[model samples]
Target: MPDEMALLVAEVFEAAGVLRRSGEAIAAADGQTQARWQLLSVVSEEPLTVARAARRLGIARQGVQRVANDLVREDLAVFRPNPDHRGSPLLALTPHGRRVLDKITRRATEVHRTLAADIPVDEIIRARALLHRLVERVNRHEGDGRIPPG
Candidate 1:
């Protein structure tokens, strides 16, 4: 069981790398990378502070902050004052950002349809369920300090 779990973990890492590269390709035409696209997508519905976005994305706050800064520089996003936290402002997409994101999303929808054309929906749902279960089990270890630091 342990060996099986280890193999699954390794496969997950490999899959993530492939997916990241694919995402970059998907967003490249829009002059955006996977990281920027993901960051924008997360905060599209509502503005979020850097920390909140980081938590939502399961990544470090500093990385998200850098991406946010880049987005702001490109005029794709803006920092608005947050009443909840004066120190950490909420990040929102500008009008230009929204337009770009919408275009990207439309393209992505078509790409996803093509990618899933050969795959059965039930299999995809099962795979997602398994990954979610894995995530839950791994997260439980964090509470008990079972995960070792790099």
Candidate 2:
């Protein structure tokens, strides 16, 4: 039999793919892609520099910059002057962007509700806990896993 840990990792990747596709469809209704929607969501709370947003999203700064530029072009978001740093401005969503994000969020909530209809809340909680533990352990390893497992 395949190692359980390996199988769990595989399952996580599969789940991510499904979730990404579902998110893409939800975002598409508002003329947005998954990447754009994610960036918008991140900045919806407060403005952050492209570098900060990229770090938060665990994605490349250049990629976030591209998405931020596109959002600005679409009038969904704006780049405002940053008092903290003159060179790197913070990315903030426009009024239109807030409406778009709200719409997408509502749609996503509905879809998630339907998807979780059959699953017990406790089971879902347990699964989330397990995933969280796995994520913490993975982060502790950083990029290299050469350390001997204790």
Q: Which candidate is the best by lDDT?
A: 2
Winning model by TM-score = 2
lDDT (C-alpha) at residue 101 in model 2: 95
- Residue-level lDDT of model 2, residues 25-75, one tens digit each, is 999998899999999999999999999999999899999999999999999
Residue by residue across 1-150, what tens digits does model 1's lDDT show? Answer: 379978988999998998788889889989999889999999999999999999999899999999999999999999999998899999999999998888888888898899899999999999999999988877888767898532
Against the correct fold, how does model 2 do in TM-score?
A: 0.93
Candidate 2 lDDT for residue 68: 97
Report lDDT (CA) for all predictions.
0.92, 0.94
> Could you tell me which 10 consecutive residues in candidate 1 have the lowest summed lDDT?
141-150
Which stretches of candidate 1 lie above 4 Å from their native place?
Answer: none
- What is residue 37's positional error in candidate 1, in angstroms? 0.3
